[model samples]
Target: MAVERFPVEASHIMMFARSVGDPNPIYHDEDYAKGAEPGGIIAPPTFVQASSQYDPDAALRPKPGQPWFGSGREPSGTPRGGGGGGGGTGLHAEQHFEYHRHLHPGDVLSAKTRPGKSWEREGRRAGKLKFSETITEYFDQNGELVITARSVGVQTERVVEQA
Candidate 1:
C-alpha cells in the first residue's frame, strides 16, 4: 500500500508509548529527550507499526462485513484452519522491528508491505495451523528507510462452538 504521506506528531508518539505502558521519557518528554543521543525526541521503536493506517486504501482496515487475513478463513470461504468463527483463534506468533534511523516528530513517513513467508504446522488441539508473515518497511520523507517490521500471524481451527 502506498501513502502520499504520514505526518508523525509528538502526541501520537506519546499516546502510543503510554498505551503500551512504556514510560520512556524519550518518547514523550522533549526536554528529557533533547539531552539523549540523537538530540531530539524520537518515536518508540514500534511506532511505525501503525503506518499502514495512513494509507488511503483500506490495506489493514477492511470494510464492514469484509473478511480479513486474521478472520481465520480466506475471502473465498475456504477455511484456513479448523476455526469456524467460534472465537478468537488467531495468534500473533512473532514480531520484529529494525530501525535504520531514528523517527523524529513531524517526520512524514510512508510504508510498503510485502508477503514474507508462510508455513503450516500440526497443532496439539486444532489439528493443523497455518502461519504467515508479512514485512512492512517504512520510509521517511527523505526516502530513507526508517524501520522494517515483520509480523507473524497464526490461525487455527476453532475448537469451540460459535454463538
Candidate 2:
C-alpha cells in the first residue's frame, strides 16, 4: 500500500516529539536545531510510524466488528472472548528502523508498505504461533530513500478451550 505524501512540518515534529515524551530541543526547538549539526528541526526516529494516519486504508486502524489480522476470531453467539473459543490478540513482536538521512521540515515523504515475510511455528502452550512481518520504506519528494522500517506481528492459536 502507498501512503499519501506526508508533509513534515515543525509543528508536527514538535507535537510528535512531545507525544513520545521526548524533550529534545532538536526536535521541538527550531532555533536550537538550526545551531546543531542537522541545521534545522528534525523528526524523531519513530516519527515514521505516524504515516499510518495519513493512509486512508491503513490495516491497523480500528474497524468495528471486523477482525484484524492477529486479532482472534469471535465464536458465533459469543461475545468477544466471552466464552466458547478465544485466542490471543494481535501482538507487536518487534520493530526496527534504518535511517539513511535526517528528516527535516518541508520534506514531503511517502511510504511504500509491503509484506516482508510470514511463518509459523509450534508452540507448546498455544498449539501454533504465526508470525507476519511488514516493511515500509519512506522516500523524500526528490525520490531519495530516507528510512526503512520493519514491524512484526504475532498471533497464537488456541490450545485449550475457553473456560
Candidate 3:
C-alpha cells in the first residue's frame, strides 16, 4: 500500500477511536491530552489502517464500473464463482504494528509497502494454504518513520480453479 498523503486531523482521530469503541480521552480531548506525556491528542493504535481510505487503489475498494456486494446508492448483485469458501480473494491472517512515535494532529503521513516472505502449508481441513507477508512503513511530514505495519494474507489452494 502506498499513500501519498494522509493528514492526521483531531476530529478524524476522535471518530476512528469511537468507531473502534475506544473511549480514551487522549484520542479526543485536547485539554486532557495537554497534560499527558505526548502533550497532545494522539491517534489510536490501529488508526493507521484508516489510511486505506486515502489509497485510491486499495484492494478493498472496488474499481470503477465494478460490481460490489455491499449497500450503496443503487442495488447490485454479488458475484458467484468460488465455492470452497476462500472466495479467491484470500483472508487476512495476521496484523502487527510497531509505533516509533505517537501520531499527533497536523502530521501529514505517507506509507510505502514492500513484500516480505512467502510460505506454503497444508491445512488439515482447509487443504493447501499459501501465506504472504506485506510490510508497510508510515512516515511523517519530516520523513521520519512513525510506524510499521506487518500484514499476512492467506489463500487456499481452492482459490484457483484446477484446469
Candidate 4:
C-alpha cells in the first residue's frame, strides 16, 4: 500500500469538529482557541484520528479473479471489513495514537499507511480467522512527524459470532 498525505486547512478542522458534535470553542472560535490552555486553536484528539482523507479512486482493491479480490481474504483465513463476518467480516479491533504537537489551520498534513502485520487464529465458534494490522503516520508540511496511528481489523471467512 502507498502512503497519502493531505493538507490540513482550517475548514477541515472545523468541519470535523462539527461532524463529531464537538462544540468546544477552540475548535470553532479562533480567538477562544488562542486563549485556551494549548495556546492556539487545536483540533480535538478524536478529530486528528478522523482525518483519514484519501482519494476515493486510489483505494486498494483486488483485481478480478484475484483470489476473492475485495472479498477480504488474505492468504490466511482472516476476514476484513466492518461487518465482522466470514468472507466479508471486518472490524476496528483497536486504535493507538501518539501526538507530538497539535494541528492548526494551514498545516499541510500527509499520511503514509502500510501493512504492519497480520495473522490467523482460532475463534471460539468460527474456528480459524485472520487479522491485519496497519500503521499510518502523519506529517506536517515541514516533513516533521506529527502523529502516528495503528489500526487493526479482523478478516474471516465465517460470520463473526456475537459475544
Candidate 5:
C-alpha cells in the first residue's frame, strides 16, 4: 500500500545465510569469499533477493474478518482487501531478480519497494481472486544500483471450494 525505503547491512546478509542453512564459506569467511570465482566473496543470489530491511507493515497484509487466504490477519475486525478485490485469497505467483553487482560485507545497501501491478482472476475452486506484484530495488552505499526484485502475490476474499 505504501512505498518504503531502508538501508541494508552486511549483518543482514549473514543472518539470512544462517537462517537459510547455507554454510558457504563465501557468505561467512571473507578470505574464502574473496577467493571465489568472481574474486570477491559474493553473497548468494538468493541471499541478495532475500536480504532486505523492509518492514512488513509497509507491505499490504490481510485485515480482520477476512478469510485466511494465507496472507495474514488484520488487526481490526474487518476483512482487508488487497490492491484489488476478487475475495481475499493471496499467493506467491512469481519472482524475478536482476543483479548489477554482488553484495559484500560493509556494503551499505538501500531498498525502495512499492506495489507495481495488480489484477483479479477466477480460480477453479476459489471463485475470484485478486493479486498484486511488488517491485524492490537495492542500491549500494555509493548510490550504485545492486539488485532489483519483483514479487507476485495472490489474494482472495473467500476460501477456495474443495474439489
Candidate 6:
C-alpha cells in the first residue's frame, strides 16, 4: 500500500491504543507523557498498521453502501483466495516490525512498500504453499525512516486443517 500523507493525531492514538486494550498513560495522558521516557505522548508499537485506513486502495476497508465484512443475518462467507495461483486461499503468515523511534502525535508519516522474497513449499494438509513477503518502510515528515514493517502472506492450494 502507498500512503501519501498520514497525519498522526492524538485522538487517533488514543483510539488505537484503546482498541488494542493498551491503557498505558503514556498513550493518552499528555501530562504523564511529558515526564515519561519519550517526554511526550507516543503511539503504540503496532500503531503504524493503522495506516491502512488512510490507504484509499486498501481492500479490507468496507466502503459506503457495501456489505459489512462481519456477520449479520447469516454468517459471513469464507474468505477469498490468495495471490500466486488463482483460486488459492490467502493467509497472513506473520508480521515483523523494526522501530527506529516511538510514533508521536503531530508526526506526518508516509509509507513506501515493495515486494520482498517469495518461495514455495509443499504442505501436509494443504497442497502447494507459496510464501511471499511485503516490506513497508514508514518515513516521518523529515523523510527519516521511522518503522520498517514486514508482512508475510501465504497462498495455499487449499485451506490447511486446524491443528
How far is 28's C-alpha from truth in model 2 (Å)? 1.0
Off by over 4 Å in 6: 65-88
The CA-based lDDT of model 6 is what?
0.88
Clashes in each model (backbone N, CA, C under 3 Å)? 4, 0, 0, 16, 13, 0
- Arrange candidates, best TM-score first: 6, 3, 2, 1, 4, 5
In candidate 4, position 11 carries an lDDT of 74
Each prediction's TM-score against the native? 0.75, 0.77, 0.83, 0.72, 0.66, 0.85
Residues 42-161, model 3: lDDT tens digits: 998999999998898886787789777655764644654445565554778899999999799999999999999999999665578889999999999999999999999887755555
Global lDDT of each model? Answer: 0.79, 0.81, 0.87, 0.71, 0.66, 0.88
Which candidate leads in lDDT?
Answer: 6
Error of 1 at 21 (Å): 1.3
Off by over 4 Å in 3: 62-65, 69-89, 157-163
RMSD (Cα, Å) of candidate 1?
Answer: 5.9
**Pairs that clash in candidate 1:** 82-157, 82-158, 83-157, 83-158
Residues forming the 10-long window of minimal summed lDDT in candidate 1: 71-80
Say which candidate scores most in TM-score.
Answer: 6
- Candidate 5, number of clashes: 13
Candidate 1 segments whose C-alpha is farther than 4 A from its true place? 1-4, 57-88, 159-163
Give a tens-digit lDDT track for model 6, residues 70-93: 576767633433344444577898
Candidate 2 local Cα displacement, residue 1, angstroms: 4.4
State residue 8's C-alpha deviation in candidate 2, in Å: 1.4
Whose lDDT is higher: candidate 4's or candidate 5's? 4
The superposed Cα distance between candidate 5 and the true structure at residue 82, in angstroms, equals: 6.5
- Compared with the true structure, what per-residue lDDT tens digits does model 4 show for residues 30-95? 888778897777877865565545433343444354443333445643343355444445556788
lDDT of 6 at 16: 96
